[model samples]
Target: MDLIAPVVLTRPAGRNAPLAAALRAAGLAVVEAPALKIERLAVAPPVLQVGDLCVFVSRQAVDACFDGRCAATPWPDGVRAAAVGAATAQALRLHVPADAILAPAEGAPPDSESLLAVIEAVGLVPGRAHIMRAQQGRDWLARQLQARGWSVYCHALYRRSPAIWDRDTCAILAGPGRCTLLLTSLEAVDAVADSLRRQAMDWPATLKLVTLHERIARRLQCIYADRPADALTVRLSAPDEAALFQAILASARSA
Candidate 1:
C-alpha cells in the first residue's frame, strides 16, 4: 500500500520514538513531533495534611511525582490517588503504596473525563486535590472542581512545548506528496498548520489526517474542507502506540 500521510504523532516525548518505530514497521513514514513535553518540576512536594487527594493526568505525571522533585513530601495520609488511565496508575506501583491508585475504565475517556468519573465513584469531595501535571495543559478537571467549590492546587509536575521542527519534516508538510498526517494534540496541529501557512504551503489536498478524537478532527476538517476529498480524517481510539499503529495501517490501506 502507498504510504498514507507522513504520520505525525502527538504523544508525549518519551512515547514518540516507539510510535515512530511502530509506524515504520507498518511500512509508513512518521514525523516525530511531540504535542506535549513532560518536564519534571524541580520543587519540593507540598506538605500534605492527614488526608488529601492525589491526581495525575498521565504516566509522565506519575513519573514526575516520585522523581525526587516531589520526594521530600510523601503522599499525605489517607490520600488515595486517581489517575487518567490504567497505564498511568500502574506506573505508580513503586512510589505510591499499592492499591492506593484507581483509574477510569480503559477507553472511557482522557484525563478530565476519567478524573470526574473516578471522583464520583470514590464518593470523595474535591478537597485539597494536588494535581500533578505537565505545564500548560488542559484545566477541565480543575475548572469543574472549582465550579463546585473544591480546593485544587497544581503540583505543576511537568510541561510540554513544541519541539524544533527539523528540515526534512518541514519539507514534507509543505511539499506535494501522497502522504497522510496524524495530529494527536491540538497544539501540535496549530503549530504545524501555522508553520505551513507561514511558508504558503502548496501541499496537495489529497493528504489524510489521523486524529485521536473527534473534536480536534472536526477543527482540522473545517480548516481544510475546501480541499480534496482524499484529505480526510481517521480517529484513533487511544493515544497508545498500538492504537496509533492501527491508525497508520488503516489509513495506508484506505483507497
Candidate 2:
C-alpha cells in the first residue's frame, strides 16, 4: 500500500483541534502549525438595533465580537446577522437566532461574493450595516455594500500576526516525509511562505497544498513559481470541514 502523507493544518491558533481530531480519527498523522495567531483588539462591539445588518467576516470575528459586554446583551429583534461562510454563520448562531442569520446556500463557495448574493436575494433595502473583522483584510464586501447605498460601518475586533513554528514543527516540514499543507485564507498562504523563507527552506518536491479558494491557490502558485512545475501541487476545496477533510485525505493519498 502507498504511504499516506502527514497533514499539516495551518489555521489560526486554537482553531485546528476539531479538524485535527477528525483526521487523526481517520488514521492520518496530523501536525498543528498555526500560520496565524489571532489577537482580540480592544474594540467595543457594535450595538445592534432593529433593521440593522451585522456582518461577520470570519468565525474569529464572531467570537471577538461577542466575547464580553456584547454577550450580556440580547441580539435585538429584527436585526439580521450575516456571515461570509458557514463556519462564521454557525458561530453567529450562538449570539443570534438561526433564522435571523443570512448565509450562502449549502455547498456554495463560502466567500464574500457568495454572501453578497444571499444578501441581495433578500432584497434588503440598503440600510445601516456593520462589519466585524480583523485589523486588515479584503474590503471587497464592504465596498460592494457601500455601492449598494448601504451605510457600512467597519469594526476591527482582532489582529492577526504570523505564528512562529517550533523546531519540531520546522523539522517535520523540512524533513523528507510526504506532507500536505492546508491553507484557508490568502493571509495564511503568505504566512506559510514567509515562515519557509525565514528558515531558508525550499518547497519540498513531495509536498502538496490544499486551499479553500481559487484565489488562495493562485497566490500559492505565484509564491512557489521558482520551484519546478511538478515540485508543488495546489488543490482547491470548499470551505466546509467535510470538504477540507476529503481534500486533505486525497492529497495525502496522491503522494
TM-score versus the correct structure, for each prediction: 0.82, 0.92
Candidate 1 global TM-score: 0.82
* Candidate closest to the true structure, highest lDDT: 2
lDDT of 1 by residue, 1-255 (tens): 555446666566676787688778767777776644456768755666645777887777777767754466555568878787656777776677766776777676555776687788777755787788777778888888777767889877766665555556666664545566777667777767655555556444566677666777787777777876657555556655577678777876666
- Runs off by more than 4 Å, candidate 2: 1-4, 70-72, 166-168
Query: What does candidate 2's lDDT look like per residue over 80-146, in tens digits?
Result: 9999988888788888899999998877888999999999999998899999999999999999999
* Candidate 2 local lDDT, residue 159: 97
Over 4 Å off in model 1, which ranges?
35-38, 69-77, 174-177, 202-204
The global Cα lDDT (0 to 1) of model 2 is 0.84
List lDDT for all candidates, in order: 0.69, 0.84
